[model samples]
Target chain A: MCELLGMSANVPTDICFSFTGLMQRGGNTGPHRDGWGITFYEGKGFRNFKDPNPSCDSKIAELVQNYPIKSCAVISHIRQANRGAVNLENTHPFTRELWGRYWTFAHNGQLCDYQDLVTGRHRPVGQTDSELSFCWLLKQMEDKYPQPPQDMASVFKFIAQCCDKLREKGVFNMLLSDGEYVMTYCTNHLYWITRRAPFGKASLIDEDVEINFQEETTPNDVVSVIATQPLTDNEEWHRMKPGEFGLFHCGELADGNADQLIDVPFAEKKVKCQAPTEPLE
Target chain B: MCELLGMSANVPTDICFSFTGLMQRGGNTGPHRDGWGITFYEGKGFRNFKDPNPSCDSKIAELVQNYPIKSCAVISHIRQANRGAVNLENTHPFTRELWGRYWTFAHNGQLCDYQDLVTGRHRPVGQTDSELSFCWLLKQMEDKYPQPPQDMASVFKFIAQCCDKLREKGVFNMLLSDGEYVMTYCTNHLYWITRRAPFGKASLIDEDVEINFQEETTPNDVVSVIATQPLTDNEEWHRMKPGEFGLFHCGELADGNADQLIDVPFAEKKVKCQAPTEPLE
Candidate 1:
């Protein structure tokens, strides 16, 4: 129902190239034209630019394309307006403060009964199912760990489990970040590509633009980008299978289960039991 | 230590004229060159533009001046960085969501021993006395009323009382909004001016800018602007008292006690009990 674009980098890197390709889809190359938003994290600090206007013609989007805002982690979204009206409040990516750190989220699917999810301390400022689920996930995490989790593995696993539960309702592709790490859950279409040493040229699929990574970075630089669709046609993009979850930190896969495609029977059974007669969009 | 600018309008009006004057003080005309931020509320939706650079020369600030982002309520700040480092995280105005509404705040004064205030569900993402006080105030409000208050008068009074308590720590001049109303509390220098049917030419104090409101606004339009100092030299601005708190809604003074200069004895006693040897900045 929407589109997502995310990035994690070992060094502060700008998403201007990938963002250009993505903006073309916001009413130009594709159908997602309601609104668009993007967040860039620089160390523990972050800022977001959101607009209810279509990104294709937005002055702010133009500024973002021209301005090189370097960040370690970035999340972006273009909405199709499935659950909320086209307004600034309902624009993705939604952000909240948890554990004294800013957490950003962007969803790319529709949930049939997401309103059933109970939100505790964190509440959605906008009337969007995406924001509702984000709040619910954060509330669940806070409930489980009153403070920051002792181990990062447990936190990643818990987030994956929550994604599995959310996938049972409907499609649940998402991108989440807390400045340091990026967690992506794929219930449908999602792809990622990492650029490291020995990088080469890549051409955008949506636009007639090309960039040589060799000229853009040093050999030590590492950058990873995740998107609903691959932005570059020539690059080798890794497509994630449905129900797969991956965690990236400092531009590299950090989760032990990053490549694993384990099927959770509990989630499958719940989905089978609550399957709607009407097909999901 | 900083400067604040706020606007409350009956109609969705652009504050570009006033903002141009204020941005001049962010480096060109004054010493508040650390950072600047501005928030504009359109109905229940709002967006902010912030930069950890001098507003006088910031490209984003230039865009803000050129583009007209109309809103009914706005809060802005230019920081001199008294209690925190100069970074994006420490930029104002800070924002948080409570009771499904976005609340924005910007402070122009320092508070000693402000970290003692207990924060509840809300937490500050940035390490600043301004954000800490904001979170504490919101936490107090939530503790008293879990849901939206039935009577706005009580909420306004409670907020004023909280401001009174915070003023005991030191100078606590602040501007706050919950999308619907703009609340201004002055512990030192703060000024306001209202423009309605009888509009005339006004000249900026910090910049050579002049505008005839007769050509820009309608006769029925009611708008109010609040700032740490008078933005325009030609306009008659009302200077508030040290202990005064005023609430503006729909571009007009809505709080019954907006003009009352009441001194809470409890706050006075606390200030007397913890009076430091050095005068507050």
Candidate 2:
């Protein structure tokens, strides 16, 4: 088991403050002390760091606490080690090249017998079922589309079905990005928040940390963050249904289909958007 | 502070067991409670889920405890909000576009006077300094390369400088990735573990979860996970030092530097990682 943190925004930003508070729980306020890691997206590149130590005590963690490596998107994790060893190779926010683009992913669940499903050019680096499951998901996607999909909704639907079947083994809460859009699925635990023109003050439940967005952001900034648990103490959070999924692009809801957010019939929840050329009041 | 969870492997994997244990800490075993999210990678596509609720109590979290989504590199977060409202927009593990690639980020620290340092194409979406810093990092990189780095090491070095400057802001433990490589920096709190051919059983420190990778993975498999804390109870975790950065690619160190592990120069260790075309020996 581990802790998860991520960010998706219209602009480049840092997770320093939030991460600082979160780090306290990694070992000090909490007990995920098996290992820790973080990934920051700097354009086409990545600023990733990890260690087989607790965030609370790791000297590197202190550096992270003090640094402000900014990026538009970020994915981070702290482990409690359930399916893998405490080593640098087993750390998360795994990366792979597909369709000529880099894709990043993170999960917060376990699979029972996922190893049997892996089959393809891609393979697992470590021995965690989490990694095996990643291989299978990618294999299936590659099978469905040799290149990137033009219609994100269709692409997400296909993966949703795949995830639906994977649920048979165990939980699967995950985050994914192709440096363009972030697609998320909630088979179990997942939560999100969207910050826009009207910003506010927020506090951490795990640590005594708080910040006000109005003081740090512009009126045009729009950002959305997702994680395995709520990070703030004073705001209201919407809980994703057990079987739910969503997409974010440029800090807005890319997948406007309610079917992905609830158990409503796919047909009932489907909400297609008109092409940009055809949009008008 | 919040928690972060990540997994990088040669094969696809689902972080069910690890996430489950982490979820308990979201609002039960731990204090993170602003929002939650996760992303799964499927070849060139992605599946993501986000909710503005605590992972421990949200029914969606229950589903993730049961479902099984997988990916090679996965990032998840449980927030204790500090910048934006406890809504869907302020969660961590944000994603954005850069040079036609998808980037993801997650942070665990704070930054002062960061607003002045970060100013460019990448901007904050939410109110957290983490998102602002992410934007600043991306802006700097995008400006620096215009194109990707000539090599992984150069890119790592560039990012390392960025991390260094940001570290001066306060705390900046972070993770960044571009699907090809996962790079991380330890400003305050970060840690990771690598699971390889010789896998072993690991137990959760915060929840009742356990798994034996040796029983499920092939010897060729190499999986790495990074987080803010150790994910297992029975394991030796390495501490990442301050002012340290590492890269994980294909479940191995890309920098090819083994000395990255002993990076803790001083200041209580924060996080910890390596590669090379030119063989060291």
lDDT for each residue of candidate 2 in B17-40, tens digit (9 for 90 to 100): 888877877878788977777765
Position B31, candidate 1: lDDT = 91
Q: What is the lDDT of residue B150 in candidate 1?
A: 56
- Candidate 1 per-residue C-alpha lDDT over B224-259 given as tens digits, one digit per residue, 9 for 90 to 100: 999999999988999999878888776876643643
Top-DockQ candidate index:
1
Candidate 2 regions with alpha-carbon error over 4 angstroms: A256-281, B1-281
Model 1 error, position B229 (Å) = 0.4
Q: Which tens-of-lDDT digit does each residue in A78-193 have in candidate 2?
A: 88778977655566767665554456777788878776785454556566776667767878988998766665556666777787777888888777776666777787777888
Candidate 2 chain A, poorest ten consecutive residues by summed lDDT: A272-281
Off by over 4 Å in 1: A256-281, B256-281
The lDDT per prediction is 0.84, 0.68
Q: Score candidate 2 by lDDT.
A: 0.68
